[model samples]
Target: MNYMDMYKRWLNFDEDTKNELLNLDEKEIKERFYKELEFGTGGLRGIIGAGTNRMNVYTVRKVTQGLANYIKNKGIENASVAIAYDSRKFSDRFAKEAALVLNANGIKTYMYKELRPTPMLSFAVRYLKTTAGIVITASHNPKEYNGYKVYWSDGGQITEEHAEGILKEISKVDYDDILTMDFEKAVDLGLFNYIDDEVETAYINLVKGLTVNKDIVEKAKNDLKIIYTPLHGTGNKPVRRVLEEIGYKNVYIVKEQENPDPNFSTVKYPNPEEHEVFKRAIEMAKELEADLIIGTDPDCDRVGVVVKNKEGEYIVLTGNQTGALLTHYILENLKTTGRMPKNPVVIKTIVTTEMARRIAKSYEVEVIDVLTGFKYIGEKIKEFEEKQSKDFVFGFEESYGYLSGTFVRDKDGVIASMLICEMAAFYKLKGMTLYEGLISLYEKYGYFKEDLKSITLEGIEGSQRIKEIMDMLRNNPPKEIAEIKVREVKDYLKGINDLPKSNVIQLVLDDDSIITARPSGTEPKIKFYFAARGKSYKDTEERLEKIKMEFLRLTI
Candidate 1:
């Protein structure tokens, strides 16, 4: 339907929706109704409001109906969908609305009674033996945004084929055809059931079992001062619980950011990937002389780390740095314990630092590079489990997401947080900090530095400009960047290296520096990733600055 028709329909629906629509300015109306909210590779994520292009009860029901149809068509005899939501605005309502839609379509639904993280939803799907899972979250998006993510029975986000099938069903759905049962009626009829606490207990126990050095944690429990902040999201309870259960007694939670606040009042951005988000935690860490600091985003799937350097100043470790450190720590521990698998495998995204490859090779373990999303990493784990070909050791991306154990298929901040603490304790017992451990790695693996630059372009015209930039770069590929010779260009759209097709271009430079340009699948922006290697930290920093400037000039 057109914007006018949609607006007219809204006017007759309810008093509050009508009032919201009536108060919108012309530009706001156009932006809200120009297009339907898309179900991207991850799922539907958009601004939360009263419009076809936003996230609301109506949109949630429509997508759930599509998912219901797809699940029925798959011929699962008695299909069920597990549901969970984070602490975002309208998250609880949207979760219930989606469950009711599924229930109305004759599917069983299991939903969480309270806010939970994304990884827990993945675990729930597998634990409940449900056919699929749905999570209401916008991840680290701003307060105005919300989202819905779908996962399959294997405890991973839906793959490309499954996404296409669901999108086809969604295309056929109309507003009037979206079916939903009353929430109370669905529960009375046994079509909807709340998730029990046992599931959570089981999940926590699974995460706690992943500790590589329980002895080390117990030894440093009292002396290893640590600071953590959930950034007003779902990580507070679970992260702290796992750490405390594993014997970390001196954990300090950032008081202001502990509780769930939709506005995320303390920071400009809720994403832990940004160092600015750690402003409050840094202050607390300094006063406590904490050995380490950790923060997780809204959904608790990604985690960021901060540690004191030799100069006595706390420094935020880039995702790559933390990832590399974790990789080496896990592998080295497994080797020492004589538990390293015969064919151990480590996984990372293509854009992540190549230093992972070097670190994995030092242990004689294989490193596999996949596409950017954590779903691809989870998919690889599923494949390995099925084929029994390679043993999955560790997986991570450059976005502060990491996975160490197979208990949860997705990137898990719960487990990552626990392991980060244990890893810190292990080094602290040796009289060194995580920053020092990272410096030692750099000394061994040639100082490698990486930077990400994202250019945001909103609205219709802005999207077109982003496309123009991508097309220009593709058609007239540069032979050199910042006076460095381009060794090769890998266009993922054409299916390079036996990977799935995607709209990504990666340039390999002669000096082993790599640059990748890919549009954000979840947001309205295009990100450029620059990686540079040098003999010293100063040399790498200079090269990174030169490359970043060149990329910015081209984009402008």
Candidate 2:
């Protein structure tokens, strides 16, 4: 059926919903119903709107109902689910609505009484031994967006096979048949439980275990001046409490963004990737002469940092740079203390810089590349646990997400915040800055800079345009980008590199630079990733600028 037919079906809805659909334009309707909410490697994320395809009450109900059916089919007599939400506009309501649907289907449910981080939801699923979990957040997406992510019993997002099963069940549900029992009734019948302080204590204890160098934190406790901002989301309480428990004496929270505000009043785009989001925090840091500034996205999964360079200017570190620095710090510290794991492994996304791989190799640690999403990294962690062949050391992605101790199944900003502060304090003891530490790593591992460019294609035609761009690149792979000879191509969708095929096509240049292109599975955009290396920092910057200009010229 056409989008108009779908829109017409909504005429039976109450006047409020029916009138809302009738007021939408053709483009709006098409955008809303262009495709189903797909279970990507990262789970479901989309702009909230009125359609079966968009994130709405009906979509949420279908997803929850599907999850309930999937859990029941697994032969678990009393299947349970945990649900949490962030501070987005409709996140809390959506989460409760999902819980209601699950309760109606005879599934036990545990939901947070208030907003919480994505990682906390992952931890809750395991702590409660629930059959599954749901987090109502879009991570760092704009205010207009929201999402629903599903996690399995192990606390990691559902694997591809399980996701397919859930999708099948979702398809079988008729929108009108999704029933919701009263919240009071569900609770009275013992089908619902609100997570409380006891669960919070368990989570905090797990986070505390992530601190490897407590002695260093003890030494720098009174001296290290650190600034942190939760960006008006769920990280505020946990992050602050963890830092305090670790003995950090002078931690400054950004006052304007300290509270949970759904609007994210302090910035235009709440994403930490943009330097502008840190303008106020940097100003505060400068005045206090703080060692570092940290900000986490709404759901507190991805983290961003700003540090003083050698020239005394505050600079925001790219996700790759931050990950590389953190990786180097953790591995070297473990080795120095003679505590390095014998069978250590470092996990990263396929698009992340190979420089981290090189650093890990130098430390005699294995580097494993997985598909995009931290869930793939979590899957690898599970693989290691079952096989006992390798120990999971660290995991990260290019999009400002990292995991260090595996206490949580997802990327954790709270732990990342604690580790980043410790790293800064470690550098301070050497009379250096985090910026200087990063530079030293570049000098040791060969200078490298990475860049990511995301081109948004909105509405129905936008997706087709993104596909056209990807197809164009695959058919006519760049022979040379900025006069550098193309040495190899890696197609991830085909699951081949020089060895296998993948949807991603990476072009290796004669000068050892690399450019890769792939369509984002969770959003309507194509991302281009570029990495260039040089003998020194100055040389690296020069080459990076040249390659960036060439890439822009070609793509834009």
Candidate 3:
């Protein structure tokens, strides 16, 4: 439908929506009504407001109705779906609306009684044996945005085939035909159920069981001083509970960011990957002389860390550094404790640091590289379980998302927080900081550093520009980058490699450097991932900078 037709539909909406539409300027109205909000490979995400292109009650119900229809068509014996939400604006309402739409379709729905992390929702789907799951979260997007995530029966986000099916169903759903029932009526009719303490306890127990060496946490729990900040989202309760339950006593919470604040008042963005997001936690860490500082994003699916270096200054560890540290720690500990599996395997994204592959290789474990998203990692876990081909040990991306156990199919920050602290504690017991441990890994594994650059191009013109850039790179491939020899080019779009098709291109340099470029699936941006190996830190940094500059020049 054109913007005018969509605007007429909005005019007939409730009074509040009508007022919101009437107050918007021409530019604002056009941005919100020009197109329907995108339901990409992940799910629907947009600024939360009134319009066809925004995340609102109408869009939420419309998507849910389509999901309901897809579920019914599958012909599951008992059609049920699990639902959870974060602390984003209208997340709870959206979760409820989705549940009501499912209930109105005579499908059973279970929703959290309170805000929960995205990984927990992934777990709840398997725990409850629901046919599918939905998590109302935008996942570190700006506060103005919200999203809907759809999961399949295996507890992973919907794959491409399922997404295509749902999208087809959504295209056929008219706004007027979307159905919903009153929350109370749905509850009384036994179609809607609220879940709380029971699921939380089960999830916590599974997280605790993932610990490789419980004795280290028990011994260092009291001496390890750690500061944590949830960034005013869903991590507040469950993260704290897991730490305390594991016998950590000196843990301190950043008071200002402990509660659920939809606005994320203190930080410009709720993303943990940004060092600025940990400003308050860093301050607290300095005051307490804390051993480590950790921060989780809004949905608690991604975590970032700050640890004291040999120079006595706290430094934020990049996602690659943390991933390497934890991977080495887990594998080494399992080997030492005689718990190492026969066919252990680690998974990483194509864009993640190649250091993970090196670390896994040192231990004789296989490393599998999947596409960008963590759901691909989860899908691998499911494949492992079904085939018994390999044992899933650790999986991580350079984007600060990590998963250790198979209990949750998504990247889990709550359990990751526990494991990261536990790794810190183990190293502290050895009279070395995490920084020192990282340096040792470099000495052993060779110095490997990575850099990621995201160029945001918004609006219609911006999107066109992004496409132009991708096209230029794909059509006129660079034979060499930064004067380095290009050994091979793996264009994912062409299915050159034995991987699923995606709009990604990877250039492998003869000197062992790699450059990957792909448009962001969930946002209006394109990301470039660069990796370099050098004899020293300075050499690696210099090479990374030169390559980054050259890539930028090409894009321009």
Candidate 4:
């Protein structure tokens, strides 16, 4: 249907929605009602307000009704789902809204008593043996946005096959036909339940068990001063509990951001990958002369780490650097401790640092590259278990996501935080810092660095422009970038490397630098990822800036 038809259909829903729609100008109306909110593999995400193209009570319920239909169509017995939410605006309401819709459809639902992390939702699905799971989170996006994530019975986000099925069901759902029941009534009918402390303990125990070396954390717990910030989101309780249970003595929470604040008042984006988000944590680290600083995004699926450099100044570590550190630590420690498993494997996205591959190779472990998404990594873990072909050791992506152990089939900041500090404690016991450990790795292997740049173009026109940029790059591929020769260009749209077809282009440079261009699946943005092998950090930094500058000039 056209925007006008969609607008009229939504006009009489509620007074507040009517007011929101009537107040908008033509341009605002077009932007707000251009199309229904996208429901792809990433699920629904948009600015929160009234409109078919945004996230609101209507859209949330409609999606749930579709999911309920999908579950019922599968002919499963005792159909149930696990539901959780983060601290985003209207998140709790959306969570309950979804549960009530499921309950009305004669399906069982379990929702968290309070806000929880996305990984916990993934875990809860398996822990509760639910048929599916849902999470209301935008995942470090600005406060204006919110999202819905769907997970299948395997405790992983819905893959393409399931997404297509749900999307089909959603296409058949009509807003007027949506159903919901009173929360109290649903509870009385035994169709609705709330999850609390019991599940949290089970998750924490599993996180603690993933530790590579427990003795190091015990020995260095007192001496290792660490500062952590949850950034006003759901990481506060579980992250802190895991650290404490693992015997870390000197861990400090940044007081300013210890509690949940939906607006994320302290930081602009609530994303841990950005250095600016860690301002307060760095200040506290400097004051305490802390050994390390760590922060998790709102949903606690991604994490960031900060450690002192040789100059005595704290700096944020890139996702690549942290992934490599964890890879080396896990493999080397397991080997030395005689705990290395046979046929162990590490997984990474196509755009993640090759340094992980090098480190994994040094230990004779296999490295598998998947498409750029944590769900793909999670899917691989499930595949490994099913085939009994390879042992999944670790998995990471460049966007501040890491995961170990199969307890949760997504990137888990709670466990990532635990293992990062443990790695820091390991280096501290050697009388060295993580920075020094990284430098040693560079010395043994070649010096490698990676950087990213993204240009966000919002609304309809912006999306068209992104497609144009991709087309230009693909039709007339870059022979060289910043004076370096491009050895080859691999267009993923043609289904390269036996992977699923995607709209991505990768340029392999003569200097061993790999530049990848892909549009963000969930947001109105196009991103560029760069990797370079240089003689030193300075060389890589300079060359990276030059390439980024020249490439943007060409693309923009």
Candidate 5:
């Protein structure tokens, strides 16, 4: 049936809900019921609205019921699930509704009483040995959006086979047939458990283990001036607590964004990648003359940093730059102190800069590239644990997500926050700013600048358009983006570089520039990842701009 038919069916409900659906405009209804919510590599994310397809209490219940059914079918009789939510609107309610749905299915449920980071949810799944986990977050989406990410016992997002099983279960359920029981009754029956301080303590202890130089932190504790913002999400308490516990003094929280506000009142977009989101924090940093400014996304899974340059202007560091600096800092510190792991391995996404790989190679640390999401990195970590061949040193993506320790399976902003503060502190003790440190890194390992351009495709046709673009690129691969020759191509979907077929095409230029074009699995957009390197910052900047302009011309 069409959206109109679905709208009519929805109107048959009780007065309030019927009115709510009726009040929505035609465009709203079309967008909501255009199609079923897809389970991408990142899980379900949609605009929160009233429909069988949107993210509402009913949809959340239906998805949870399907998950519960899938878990039961796997012969997990005494299965348990951990649940957590961020500061997004309806996140808490959606989490509780999901827990209750699982509870009604005779599964044990452990949910956080309040908002928490996405990584902590992953950690709780492994630490508590739960059968599965659910996190209510949309990552860095707008305020009107929300999401549900399902994770397996290994703490990574559900794999393809498991997700297919859950999808089948979801298909079997009728929207009106989703069963939900009373939350109070679920508690009384011993099926629902609200996690408390003990879990927090365990998580905090795990974070404390991520610290490398306690003595360095001790020496620079009082000298560091750091400003942090949670972006009105879930990082406030845990980030501050960890910093204080690590012996950092004068760490200032962005007062306006300290509390949890579902609307994220302080910023237009809650994403840390966007410089506008850090306007308030940056202002505060300038006033306080702080050494650095750090901000985390809604679920506290990604982090962004800003440090003062030599001209006294704060410059926002890209994810690639941040990862390189942090990785270099950690490994160099470890090596200097004679603590560097013998079999260290660093992980990054396929689209991340090759500069990171070169830097790791210089340190004799192996760099492994995975698909976009952090789960692939987590899977690699699991593989390393099983094979006992390599030690996981660090994992990062070009989108500002990084993980220092294996305590969390996903990208962790809290850990990133702690480490960033420590890095700033370490640099301050050496009488340098974070920006200077980054410059020095570039001078040592050739200057590298990466630019990412995303073309948003919305509604039903948007997905098809993105796929069509990918198909076009695959069919008629670009020989040269500008005047430079395309040397080789690496396709990730085909799981090979030049040896096999893949959806991704990386064009290598004569000047050593690389251009990668791929459709974003999580969002309805096609992203162009550009990486250019040179001997100096000026040379790198000029080449980067030239490459960017050439890419735009070719794509257009």
Candidate 6:
């Protein structure tokens, strides 16, 4: 059916959805009905409403039924899927709906008893040996957005191969063909079941085991004062449990933002990458004189840190800073203690800071760069497990996602929180703060600064405009950026370095600076990533500013 056909068809859906559609103006109607909510590589994500282009029961069911078909075709008898949800609007409803649809298609589902983090879903998939997994969340997007992410049995987000195959099946599914059954019936038929604490316990235990400086955690227990905020999402219980159990008693929660609130009432955007989201936490950090503050996003997959600088002002650290800090802590401790795994390797995305590569090389640990998603990192981990060529120690993306252990392939904000707290404690015992620890890393690994700028272009015309912008850059590769000569330009879409083909470009500058342009995998935006280094912070930042100014001038 075309847009009108789908619109008319959806008009007769549930009364609540129909009412939502009836209230929309002409433009809103077109925007919501312009096309089917795209089931891209990640899965469904969009504004919630009643339209072909919106997230609703009909669309969710259609996608679930398609997943059911793909799983059934895998020839695995009695294959099941693990399901989890975050604290998002309709997250529970979409999760239950997906479960029942899968049940109706003869595939069993093991769903979390309550809302959980995305990494928990990834862990559940592998722990339960399910055929696939699904998590209903939009990560750190604004409250109006919700999403569904699919994971293969590998405990990682689906890669391009699985995405392409599953999307083909999703496209073939029709509304009439999308099967769903009663929740009670599904449960009675042994198709719907709640996940037990077995998986949860195992997950928390794994996160706790990733702690490197165990003795330091105990020593700093009395000294380090930490404040945490869940940002009205799902990181509350596990993050606190990990910290408390690992030997920290001074952990404080930002009560105002502690609960699971879909509205994310306090923050305009629920993303931890943004400094604004740390406003409340910063206030609490100042009041309590906290050693550091940590905030995780809605799904609890990404974490941001705020620390008191030498000037005594709380500032949020960039994802790159946090990532590099964690990398150094992990490797330095391992090397000093002689516990470093043989042939240990660290992985980072192409757009991540070059400092990670440099730090890993300093430790004699191999560093490999993949395309821009953690799924690719997870893929490398899987490859290592099979080939036994190298041991995967850590992987991270510049967008505040990090993973240490192989228990969960996706980023675990809970683990990150625990490890970050441990790192802080380790530094405090050495009589330094996390910010000071960050500076120390800079000194050892050279001064580095990174920034990201995103241009959001929503709606139909905005989508077209994004394509034009990418086309402009691709067709006419800039010879220079921000007055610096472009030493080399790498276009990944043409398939570079044997990595998966993606619509991304990276410009390496003559002065050892780096810039990358890539559309967000989960949002309708184009992002530019800049990384710079110099003898001092001011020099690097000045060069960074010039590059940013010129890049924007060329692209925008």
- Each candidate structure's TM-score, on Cα atoms with residue i matched to residue i, is 0.99, 0.97, 0.98, 0.99, 0.97, 0.98
Q: How many backbone clashes does candidate 5 have?
A: 2
Per-residue CA lDDT of candidate 6, range 1-556, in tens? Answer: 5666677787887788778778878888788887887776678898877777877788889888888888888788878999999999999999999999999888999999999999999999999999999999988888898989999989988888778888899889878898889999998889999999988999888888888867777778877899999999999998998888887878999999999999999989999988998887888888889999999999999999999999999989989999999999999999888889989999999989889988998999999999888888999999999999999989999999999999899888999998898898888888888999988888887888999999999888888988888888788888987667889888899999899899998889999898888987778898999989999889989989889998899888
Task: Please provide, for model 2 over 1-556, each residue's C-alpha lDDT reduced to its tens digit, 9 standing for 90 to 100.
Answer: 6767777887676676788788888887776766678764466788787787778887888888887887878889778999999999899889999999999999989999899899999999988998989999988888888999999988999987788888888888877778789999999999888997799888888888878787888888899999999998899988999999878899999999999887888888889998988999999999999999999999999999999998889999999999998899899888988989979999998789888988998999999888777888889888898898898989999889999776578899988888899999999999999999988888788888888889888766787788777787778776787787788876677765232244677778889888888887788888888888898878888887888788768765
Query: Candidate 4, 78: how far from true, in Å?
Result: 1.1
Per-residue lDDT tens digits for candidate 3, residues 75-137, read 878899999999999999999999999999999999999999999999999999999999999
After superposing candidate 3, which stretches have Cα over 4 Å from the reference? Answer: none
Per-residue CA lDDT of candidate 5, range 161-233, in tens?
7888999998898877777789889999999999878888899988988887888888988878889999999
Per-candidate RMSD vs. true structure? Answer: 1.0, 1.7, 1.0, 1.0, 1.8, 1.1
Model number with the top lDDT: 4
TM-score of candidate 3 versus the correct structure, residues matched by position: 0.98
lDDT of 1: 0.91
True-vs-predicted CA distance for residue 355, candidate 1, Å: 0.3
For candidate 1, lDDT tens digit of each residue in 470-556? 887788778888998889988899998788999999889999899899988888889999999998999999999998898678666
User: For model 4, how does the per-residue alpha-carbon lDDT over 13-126 read when each residue is reduced to its tens digit?
Assistant: 989999888887888887878888989889999999999889999999999999999999999999999999999999999999999999999999999999999999999999
User: Cα lDDT for residue 519, model 3?
Assistant: 90
Measured with C-alpha atoms, the lDDT of residue 121 in candidate 4 is: 98
Per-candidate Cα lDDT values, in order, are 0.91, 0.86, 0.92, 0.92, 0.87, 0.89
Give each model's clash number: 0, 15, 0, 0, 2, 0
Candidate 3 lowest-lDDT run of ten: 490-499
